[model samples]
Target: MTRIRLLTVAWLVLFPLAGLADYLEVRRETAVYKEPSKKSEKLVTVDPAERSPYLLKLASGAKTKGYYQVNLPGANEKGWIYQSYVRRYKGQHPGYVAYKRTFYKHWIDEDGDCQDTRQEVLIRDADAKVAYQDEDHCKVEASAWKDPYTGKTFTNPKDLDVDHVVPLKNAHESGAWTWSAERKKQYANYLQYEKHLLAVSASENRKKADKGPDRYMPPNAAYHCEYVRIWTKIKRDWELEMTEAEGEKVQQILENCN
Candidate 1:
């Protein structure tokens, strides 16, 4: 709670990681501008490479609206980079444990309409209309959903599992283990972004459990780029760190994207 400030607006997802970072890491191809604005002269590029993440140290805690005052990696001098282009970084975080029956993890019904996040995704992703468990449509029973992971179609809701594109376990290891329970709850049931959660085959989700693109990807080769893109976007948006292997894999796919 001390590190986070909640905004009063709707869709207020605070992007700060629960843990404090000792250094700043470039998220993508970031330019070190001579000043805080883009119109300022570009000093150099700070991009992540196979073995390097392009770390920066703060010259001072000075603020400039939407930029960080940091020292360029080797030059050790003041430069400015956009806030969104860099992420706070610490070293390796071990994230391989399986999930537990946590208090907040039960399917969330944010709208108090009884159709929990799971049901909502089922309904939203349906190729056509969906049936419900009750007259009020509180629970989705069946829907025609096309599984992007396997590129297969399923009509029964039981055949699908709503998946977190960046799996919870992976998130915990990356930076979310420090997240407040409420934040974890929000992420577990988040529906703000369509690609954040997907309705894919149950078996496909199980088979690809707790692994990154470096270790596993959707069986549908056609889905590789989209999968990587979603994975990268989710990681960047959440300010989560990718493991070396994971980072390399994502970078490779992104470099080849057309």
Candidate 2:
């Protein structure tokens, strides 16, 4: 009777059609942790080779913030892994390689709404209703935005630059170089996460161009904590690597958050 019950349980875990969303295959060797945060204890490493780790996603929702609870194959262990590490398994390998800035092009109209990513960001982050030049609302003429990096406010949309918190070059050097071009485009124009992109003064954006926290921070010291926090979160979310000096500077700034 116990053997029958054990088999039933295994069947439910293996083929959870009722609650299952899909399966994700590990593309890279990544660690599953007891919690979603990297600060939490690591439970096990899920490698693409050997057993070739595949995770069964039991539900549509993440188990924790930014993590999915997955049933790891053959290990009889279940743990949370960052969603970024897993891609939906469809029998085709993604062929991930290291990111190069040349691999990516500037933002296009991904949603086909006629507005390109820059215009979309300008409209979305604007403090007031954005003024459009044409009838299609594709071209942004003006808007009010406060630049977090410089603590300066601007009324003209041309004065603001849509900045990638972790610049494309930095991302390429970190882990993004290994991602597909589609993924790189998504990262470049990511607006779903507020931390990923910002409308800042063009001068400030140029000052921070492609440099990490170690080399440059916002000129406004008052914005240091918030800037570092957003920068840290973006790097962590994307699983990007930070140099020792960059990491230390970010940590010091983060301490000021308290």
Candidate 3:
């Protein structure tokens, strides 16, 4: 088994492909897999104490969705590692703090579509025809969005904020503090589901900033059930924990949901 793994690693090293950039430090110890999928064979374990590994960005058969192709240290082995367990290393250690806006970078255009995650959400959730600022259709100039929290309507994009239903700080406190920087970015700019991010009135979002259901609920009582529903869903999707008060409040709100 070990000989076969060594042969595979040697093949990759002999014919290195292109687009291999970025060094990633293991935030937590995790296994290196023969393929990108977790169901694939596990070849080796990466420890946090070892020097950071290099992430191959675009090598042929190297990178896959949500995983990075890496060359392990002290061996000739190459395997795919889950991106969540590693961070792009810049000489800084991994750590997160509550309400730390500086730690997460939102509005990333991971798809290379010129339109960032923020603009994409604004365009998607708009109730009316969205106006584009440029020919590329990347920037959203104006749009009408209804705030679920305040029941307010705004035609200007500036009036609305793309709110993380489970705010960054809240997630950090719950369990994200242990996550790598890459994982935090994924949570902040998550576009997998509409409920994860919402277009809401800026003022209302500020009022509810980083507060869980225990301490805060939307001012628009009619939307309380939906708000809590989205909140609970986000927490569950990310495997976050809820405080006793938060759990009780969410349960109460759910009971009132029609």
Best by TM-score: 1
lDDT string, candidate 1, 1-258, tens digits: 112111211211121222233457666776777888999987776545421334555555656978888744323246787889877645332321334538238487898997889888888899988888899999887768999999999998888999999988877756555455677788888888899999999999999888988899899988999999888777755546565578677777777878
Q: What is candidate 3's lDDT per residue for 31-63, written digit by digit as tens?
A: 878888899988876565432232222223334
* Steric clashes per prediction: 0, 6, 0
* Candidate 3 least-lDDT 10 residues: 10-19
Clashing pairs in 1: none
> What RMSD does model 2 have?
13.1
Cα error, residue 197 of model 3, in Å, equals: 0.5
TM-score of candidate 3 versus the correct structure, residues matched by position: 0.63
Better of 2 and 3 by lDDT: 3
Q: Which of 1 and 3 is ahead in lDDT? A: 1
Candidate 3 local Cα displacement, residue 13, angstroms? 46
Query: Model 1 — TM-score against the truth?
Result: 0.66
Cα lDDT of model 2 by residue, 158-249, tens digit: 78889998899887765455455676777888878876788889977888889988899888899898888787667655545555677778
